[model samples]
Target: MSFQDWEITFEERTEELVEDYGDSWRLKFDDNIEPDNPAQDWFQYIRGAFARFQCSKCKKTWPSRRVLVVFHFRLDGRKRKGTVEARRFRQECRRCQEAKMEEPQFDSDNIEVLLEKLVERIRMRCYRETLDGIQRDFRPVGRSEGPHESSHCEACLKGVCRKAE
Candidate 1:
């Protein structure tokens, strides 16, 4: 399938999976199954995730309209690893970007920090086909995955910022 179509499907699957599972696998199914000769599905799947950005200056939120990318590298003590990034996302308010460039120290306007959070959200959203593929082809037991439960801190939910600053 084409990559764009893959993203929508991936997003749906990730949302569905996360509702039940609470997180994506650190290494996706195909990543684990065929590590030595890994399939390119991980790249295909991650390309579909979306990260939205909210302008701290104007408080306007927009879909970053950026595709997430996975970077692979080797560490001295570890096997090959991957991390996601939205490095090219620059669609935010021009004024904000200009302000960031001039100051570069405002916590709220830090592009890297924004991109990091965006990447985190994108990563949380990219595991549908992987899990579905495995379950469809290889679930030996019929047992349910688990209960679907939602948890939240009541204070946080009520918009009360409780942290000491």
Candidate 2:
């Protein structure tokens, strides 16, 4: 059979693999679930994503309302020590705007600690389902990967994050 007959969908591809291997394909092969295009991994990550959120006071959950949170962390790649800063924008909460002390607050002297918290919030805020459940390793692109053209995104290095400061 010509390859053209195989539909370009995941289910179709999986079926094609199974037919060729007598259902042992799954055991013999690792999952090729990543996006067909490699560039999609990084490009999509730089773009915004979302996740489920539950309101404490209303006792309800909703996925409609969302926020854009821009973030970066600065630290030595080898030592892995640095502070992370994030810009989170959300319209003032109806309940929070009305009451001054309705919400709790805390502070931290250690930047690393705060950065960890920010990263965690981003994970919860960004819906994994929306991003295809793939996490980019953020390693430096090799010569074979793509053009080494000069650009703002050239290096995903630690100091690069500090530039946002």
lDDT of 2 by residue, 83-151 (tens): 223332222223332421111111122122323333343333431222233333212111223222122
The deviation in Å at residue 133 for candidate 2 is 14
- Looking at candidate 1, what is the lDDT of residue 67? 20
Model 1 regions more than 4 Å off:
1-48, 75-90, 94-165
User: Clashes per prediction?
Assistant: 0, 3
| Full-model lDDT for every candidate | 0.29, 0.26
